[model samples]
Target: MPKLTLDDLAKIREKTKRLTTIRVGGEYRAKVCVHMGTCGIAAGARTIMNALMKELEEREIHDVLLTNSGCAGLCSREPMATVEVAGQAPVKYVDLTEKKIKEIFEKHVLGGKIVQEYALGIGSEKTDY
Candidate 1:
């Protein structure tokens, strides 16, 4: 493997810290999981995921853990995501577009408010933290 420099190591550390940081003492303030199943990919989940990463980086927001899961089981809502916030009900947004992802990031992720119009519904499970 190529030798890593101090700067490179620091950058890696920062990213790891961001991903592992807990939102509410021990839970993520918000978790953004993109469904990468075949159907989801066909629907543009990759675009949504890229948009989300850019948005978060530009905003210097790192508390949110950006992850990908196989499928959300909502094929009709192919490019969908489940935003789980600490102490609040998780909301699943459907039919995502680039514009919609930004709205969800600004309103739901940053502002701590769910975008009901784009959301299918709040999830039943709650976080233990």
Candidate 2:
């Protein structure tokens, strides 16, 4: 294989640094998974996700991974969000709105407290062998 030049190396370094900013690595402190299934979309999942992104940006939080997922077989509970912190059980929230999202960010994400009112249940983890 051809060796990478200094310019290429510099570009790689820059990309890595940028990834650490808005990107989540294996050492991420937490993850926010937004359900974007068809039902979720009809129920305003996009808006909820935008609200979440705004909150993360406004708070300048970088240790959290924000991702999207399919349905959780709870179509009635569309526009849901799941928060999974390192070393802690993931909590799924239902009927999410912008206001509720901010509340979740403040109470659950930042303060490490779970909001039972909006919370649905614990999210199951995926394991790869």
Candidate 3:
């Protein structure tokens, strides 16, 4: 592979700083993971990611960040996602469609509330992390 130029290095540094800021001073402002395995894409992970980005923008919460990861060992719930707040426990939300993404954003991200019905409990055996 070609060596990275100075400009490329600078851009990478800028992005690193931005990502650090989004972590919100040791507290995670928000963490959204969109499962991106083959099954997940088939189940609309793309739409979920789009909705999440739109909601984060609309809420004007610059600290939140979005990411994609491989399957979370739950292919039956292919498009599964997890949200983790600074102090609160992480919650897994399954069966995500675009509409549900908005609801999750509103209740969980903006309001600092967990949609319990949709949330797989923090201590559930399925939780690997």
Candidate 4:
């Protein structure tokens, strides 16, 4: 690689700062995991992921992170997803659609409220805190 100029160094520093900030402070809003295993793909995981990305972008939530993971052992209910907010329990949502993913982003992420009706296994009852 060529020697970095002052401007290049500054850009690198700025990107580093942004990445650190995102890692440390972003989890509070929501952590969304879209299962993208074979079963999930067959059930439309791509559309769900796209919807989530669009909603987060439209909302201007730059801190929010989108990730892909393997199956959560719920292949019978393919396209399963999970959303976990900082200081709150993670909730599993089954048979997800793009519409429902958007609803989850709004209600759970923006509104700070869980959408219980679609949750498959909520750990709210077991928590002592």
Using lDDT, give the best candidate's number: 2
lDDT of 1 by residue, 1-129 (tens): 669988999999877777666543444568898889999999999999999999987887766878878877778987998887767877888999999999998898888988989999888333344
Cα shift from native, residue 45, model 3 (Å): 0.4
Predictions ranked by lDDT, top down?
Answer: 2, 1, 4, 3
**Highest TM-score scorer:** 2
Model 3 lDDT tens row, 52-119 = 98887676566776878877777888688888776777788898888887888888976789888777
TM-score of each: 0.75, 0.79, 0.72, 0.74
Q: Cα lDDT for residue 92, model 1?
A: 87
lDDT of 2: 0.85
Clashes (backbone N, CA, C under 3 Å), per candidate, total: 2, 0, 0, 0
10 residues in a row with least lDDT, candidate 3: 120-129
For model 1, the local distance difference test gives: 0.84
- Model 1: which residue pairs collide? 23-27, 23-29
Off by over 4 Å in 3: 1-27, 123-129
Q: After superposition, how far is residue 110 of candidate 2 from its true place, in Å?
A: 1.2
Mind giving the per-residue lDDT tens digits that candidate 2 earns over 26-93?
46778889999899999999999999889877877767789888887788988898998788999999
Query: What value does the lDDT take at residue 100 in candidate 3?
Result: 83
Candidate 3 has a TM-score of: 0.72
Candidate 1 regions exceeding 4 Å error are 1-27, 124-129
